[model samples]
Target: MTESILVVEDEVRIARLLQIELECEGYRVSIAGSGHQGLELYQEQQPDLLLLDVMLPGFSGIELLRRIRAGDADTPVLLLTAKSSVEDKVSGLDLGANDYITKPFQIEELLARVRAALRLASGRKKVETDSWLRADDLELNEATREVMRAGRTIELTPREFDLLVFLLKNKRQVLNREQIMTAVWGYDYYGDTNVVDVYIRYVRKKLTQDNQEELIHTVRGIGYVLKDSL
Candidate 1:
């Protein structure tokens, strides 16, 4: 069966264009004009992939992605943003978007990104795993993207989870800010320190709460390191 793709875009022209292009590529395509409608279709159709616009009328794409990831992690979401800022890209990727594309992008690049995301989601692409990493109560299952703390499930945004997993994998190894950015955000990052800072703050706030000893330690003027003793 052909993989089904759902395009959630508020702009009529973009939606129509994507429908035509994707259908021509011989894949099933569906379109929703708003987050509400997109989510409704998602529950009903359960499309194999989602093409979500960052800006929406009723609900923001980031909010929608959060909701979707809360329920399902297997579904691949490609976030399309008009803003090309590094912060925006980092935010989208942090929120669980498999791929991020700024608007006015080349059609070929968009399609390639889509295919790569799908391939990764579908297990067609190989991903290196770090076996397992443990830091105090937090345990990271790198291969499965599962995180647990003291036997309690710790819900994390995709980027937050990735950041934590990466840190844990290289536990005790001080990873500089640039290294973290390059590893988590890929080489596309254009020297955005705020992206790293913002995400690290988010990770620290969300993952370590209720007086839990923080596992992610920040070395002054350096970067971050994950240590169980911290």
Candidate 2:
């Protein structure tokens, strides 16, 4: 099946160019000029990936991302923003954007990111013999995309959920930031590694919401490991 992409860019010329190029690449494309319409189309289409802009009329892309991640945690969202600061990018990534490209981006770069995001999303959805991933009392239902600890549910953003899944799959293996970022985020992150730390904290906070033990252990000066006991 041809993968679908929703382009939520207010810029008409850019949107047209992206749609033309993306369609040429054989993807089913949908365009929304405002954040409101973007969200509406997003619900209606449920595209495989989103090419969303940060600036949009009414609600911003960040707000749109927040709303989508509130319910759907698997769709790949690649933000299209003009903001180039690390802070700006981190803000989007924190909101669960799979990746981002600043405006004036090369078509090649943008296409590459689109492919990577879709590929990562596809890889995560592959069926496995085991439906549940667990560590002690903490468990994740891949089929349901639910996380639970000691029978209590934990709500996680898309990024946090992916991070936790990676950690759980690696169990006792110590995974460095580089390895974690590559496996979870698809492409190697060019920004600060703090993004990994930020996500780890998010997952840890949720997993231990009721004073549960932190199954993810930090190895000072190295990285982190998920284990029943450190």
Candidate 3:
């Protein structure tokens, strides 16, 4: 699944910068300009991660954090605060923020922390859901990250595994490249490369190894669809 992030920032330029950066990293990003809108988006979207600014127009980030933590203590929230004082950090942390970064910090550092937070969230999610996703003879174990097709174990790279999971979850549906890229790769390709096609070929090659039947079919001028014909 694609990780969604809601960024609550009153600064237009900063919000746009964050949307672009996070989307490029394959995360679905939403921007909210005030605490009210942030709260609305938070309840509606339930994003996987949140990047909240400490200062806002309607309500303070601290108050927003408090409101969110009242109902949700699980979603990872990282505060973007200009204050470097320990008290300020502690305040947000007390309100249940996973971490905070002082403003005017490097984007690289923020991105790294975002990755860490999402990983932590993903880990927690593993034990809560059924471990297996299946279609016909193919099976994917979410916990073990294992894939097996027609009694043959197939090893896949991490990205390939994510793509396969997305495909399996939406089996029998015709999925376009943009949707596939956003869901699997977590970003829009913008014609930057034929990554979707390349990865499809990679997966097909492995799935059809040893004369196994092909499960992924092309829709010609459209996109690809996964439907087991067995």
Which candidate tops TM-score? 2
Off by over 4 Å in 1: 124-230
Worst 10 residues of 1 by lDDT: 123-132
Which scores better on lDDT, 1 or 3?
A: 3
TM-score of predicted model 3?
0.56
| TM-score leaderboard ranking | 2, 3, 1
Per-residue CA lDDT of model 3 for 61-121, tens digit only, reads 8899999999988899999998556776889999899999898878899999999999998
Which tens-of-lDDT digit does each residue in 1-230 have in candidate 1?
79899999999998898899888877799999998999899999999899999888899888889999999877899988876567767887897888888887787897888888788876732342444578888877767667778887878899898888788778899999989998899988786677898999998887777778888888999988888863
For each candidate, give its TM-score against the true structure: 0.54, 0.58, 0.56
**Candidate 3: global Cα-lDDT?**
0.90
How do all the candidates rank in terms of lDDT, highest first? Answer: 3, 2, 1
Give the lowest summed-lDDT range of ten residues in model 3: 185-194
Give the better candidate number (1 or 3) by TM-score: 3
Choose 1 or 2, whichever is better by lDDT: 2
Evaluate all candidate structures by whole-model CA lDDT and list the values in order. 0.84, 0.89, 0.90
Query: In candidate 3, residue 147 scores what lDDT?
Result: 90
**Cα lDDT, model 1, residue 91:** 80
Candidate 1 versus the native: TM-score? 0.54
> How many residue pairs clash (N, CA or C atoms closer than 3 angstroms) in each of the candidate models, in the order given?
0, 0, 1
